[model samples]
Target: MLLGLAGNSCIGHILRCFRAKTHSSFTSPINSFQFSRSIYCATMASAAAGETRTEPVYFSDTYLFSFDKASVLKAEKLEGDSNDYAVVTDQTIMHPQGGGQPSDQGEITTSVDGTDVVFQVKQVSKAKDSQEIKHIGCFSSGSAELLPVGQTVKMTINEDMRRLHARLHSAGHLLDTALNRLNASDLIPSKGYHFADGPYVEYIGNVANEERDKLMASMNEVLSDLVKENIATQITVGDSGERIVSIAGLPCPCGGTHVKSTAEIGPMKVTRMKKNKKNMKMSYSLESS
Candidate 1:
């Protein structure tokens, strides 16, 4: 769950959503003013020394974008039981690990009128209700005063880390498609799956040992062939609609980010495959050189 503003009454509600959905959902009320357009005016008009405005669009839809040069309109301490950290920014490139995926890690460099003062950024998260993203990182305690609300800052992501995540995530899609092909009618689409830090993935269902083997072999064959992989991503609302993409003969609706091609995932191997009492589980990790 993403952190909330301290002393804010919404803490209980935010925590409940975190437990129930394993996804961040903000429900706090913002002033009638539109967050983006009013940032500058709000910052100057506030009597509170640290008060600032927030824009939700900064976090909700950005899959890949640069925040290295974006400004900081607000950096209030978020309310939450955990003290790990949270601060809203004008714009960010870091992807928060939510929706079963892990959050992005990186740094934010703060400057005062073009002169570098301090660099901050360690953890990033999506704020509750606001849809704006937050970064929790180390900074000079005194530096907070130096970089007031509304000051501009530059953000950069750890590209290598992001690439690794993208590779594992794309592999997950392949695994899902492979399961569909093997069972045809018996296996169901993902009821639970994750492509996080360990790069671990799980497909839930019931299947026999022999059936599991055939599914694994089929997946390996596709990886071995090194067939070109292409992904087309789009946003759609609700059921009654579908998105299709060709992967050999597999097509499915997915909204997550993926590598441009399967070749980028080079030589994948299924390290572990087994079935629980009622569900078949597949575990995979990158092959060692």
Candidate 2:
């Protein structure tokens, strides 16, 4: 859908500025593709580590909560998703959804003497300019006027929610591993729906119902056994500059928070698998022990 402005080109730019699709009331694969791709591109091109830019703390420590103090840089009013404000900090521990994982939900607080001022982070994301990461939420005081630039804040993430997200995302990678183990690397991974409602990894291939059922059972068993094996999850930067997440030696391009080891993912289950015309959507879930 080519969205062009009839009166002025500036209007199109303004529309793009408010990237939230809430007002559009249109939901299509094409629109979703563009939105998710835009986030991916921003995540990839963001400020690199240790180069005089706000560092993505999750890149180094995903388990970190109550992260060290960070100076507030900018606060942009990002309307939509509850009239949230995009807070840019000198550094962040909240992981934005990228490369097929959901974003972290958390809060950041600043203290004065003994009094604490809090900011609830409803969503985390990177600005399209790739300059800084945005912790999108509203101030605890119900007004953005309280959050000012240069103020230092302490960050805290929702550990339980973050862990669940890690498990789900790791499950997605495990599913991809299962595909490769079956010599089905030809099923290129295109996108992923990692949120809790109905998470699945979309691949570019049509699979028969019978084959998908067998896959569900077999992959579930493998993931379960792998978790029992207690294989640690390792992360490293790729030659092409993508953050690679690997488990039991199988690697995948990912830029999202994850558990430290396969053991941390309590119990794995293959919940659903369905065909989307030409795409195969493999769904799964994690059971907490």
Candidate 3:
């Protein structure tokens, strides 16, 4: 739930596919323009907005990449996007939390009878079952009442924050690639902590302290090579329809948002390495590139 102001056209192609499936006694919502899904984004009656919409995935398309504007599908306060505030849009550019990456925070603004209604988004999250993106936050200023459904609003993401997040995320993958080059792929990549606050990429490998420094130096070298090469980041689907993000140097399946190329990540430094009974953690942060 959130405190509320805010909220695509690629919907036509999707609607056609759904119609074809209806005649075949099968319906699937997994084929949005972004990534393949096993289930369609669920839609429900928004009590405040007075309309229904399939799950939105505009954020996944790097091209539609602008978090500039959207129409409000639903809006309610004290029961909205987050605790006491939130808004649901027909489609959203705001990236919701997923893949261990934190949600994006931003602002939404719309005109009501010539008055600007502003909604400050504090959080954006994706629900597990339906995987819907919810823009949760508070009204910076404007009527506290539920924003009328079908209203149009402008969106503005915190650019610096988004960049920081993307860099951390790409850095994690770069390290994964480095590990593979070192033939330590047995590290069996595990979970990832990509947030700017203490970002790290964890792996299943646990080596003695003597082995840690050697591994760190190798990873830094990979980073150096990546910068010099300016390798481009590419996205594609796997045979199983999983979203995969790959670099010229490494291959891995990742749904997290990333920069356009290795250079965009600038330079990164390996700060620390730690071992636990269960997992080995690689802590890293950005260096002035």
Candidate 4:
């Protein structure tokens, strides 16, 4: 995990790294937002108007890895690119690169005229203020078939990478709970970079220099015990419509995917603590599973 300060920018692309069922039914712990059991249709009118939104299935089920029924909305071959193409789907299990978590790497597969075609998804991203998620990559070599818009395809994300991202994201929240246990709950959370390069959480508050060492040691102890207790993560609807994730019953407003339980987060250690101005950035890591 990333050890850099929370405010440090994450590299746009990680060096080589890192879904499930169509219409899969997953009931979150809270009666927040109910997801449709089918892909949202992009009307021809909207497609003609160049407007389409992807239904993010990962929001409802973080553990789902393979989705069998995602319809391709558009496939455009780049003009000056090296056999590169961009694809958009009606529904996706791929988590786009955002919110400090990295984009999911995977492949989209579909058969055309009794021949198999694959689009290797190298990066997933969504435009700012847009719901459409674009999968950018190239068709597997030897075949230059572009997926027809409206053709059904299957999506399978790299499960190991997804799990690692979930673990990292969850570990960040666990640190928040540790702060509360340390009686430093007054520190306002400012930024969290859960990227694998060096995950860290920054708080806009201060702890005395003399007390810092004790705090880090105690924080690690609390995190170890929390993992041992194997507390299940809970999701509940807040007064507003936001999804509130509670790790070990400590609530935080978060949109990133997370592990199912604290145990799944494995062992986490606060590797470094730095006080930058009024901000305290705590870098951490989790044991590899």
- Candidate 3 regions with alpha-carbon error over 4 angstroms: 1-69, 79-83, 144-146
Task: Report how far off residue 30 is in candidate 1 (Å).
Answer: 32
- The stretch of ten residues in a row with the least summed lDDT in candidate 4 is 12-21
**TM-score winner:** 4
lDDT of 2 by residue, 121-201 (tens): 998865333546778887774355555778777889999888787777776666665565666655666666667887777
lDDT of each: 0.47, 0.63, 0.61, 0.71
RMSD of 1: 10.0
Cα error, residue 101 of model 4, in Å, equals: 0.8
| RMSD (Cα, Å) of model 3 | 9.5
**What are the per-residue Cα lDDT tens digits for candidate 4 across 103-143?**
88999897888888888999887765465788988888324
Runs off by more than 4 Å, candidate 4:
1-50, 78-80, 141-145
lDDT of 4 at 193: 83
Ranked candidates (TM-score, high to low) = 4, 3, 2, 1
How well does candidate 1 match the true structure in TM-score terms?
0.64
For residues 153-213, write the lDDT of model 3, one tens digit per residue: 7877777777777777777777765665667745766667777778877666587889889
lDDT of 1 at 253: 32
- Per-candidate TM equals 0.64, 0.75, 0.76, 0.81
Candidate 4 or 3, higher TM-score: 4
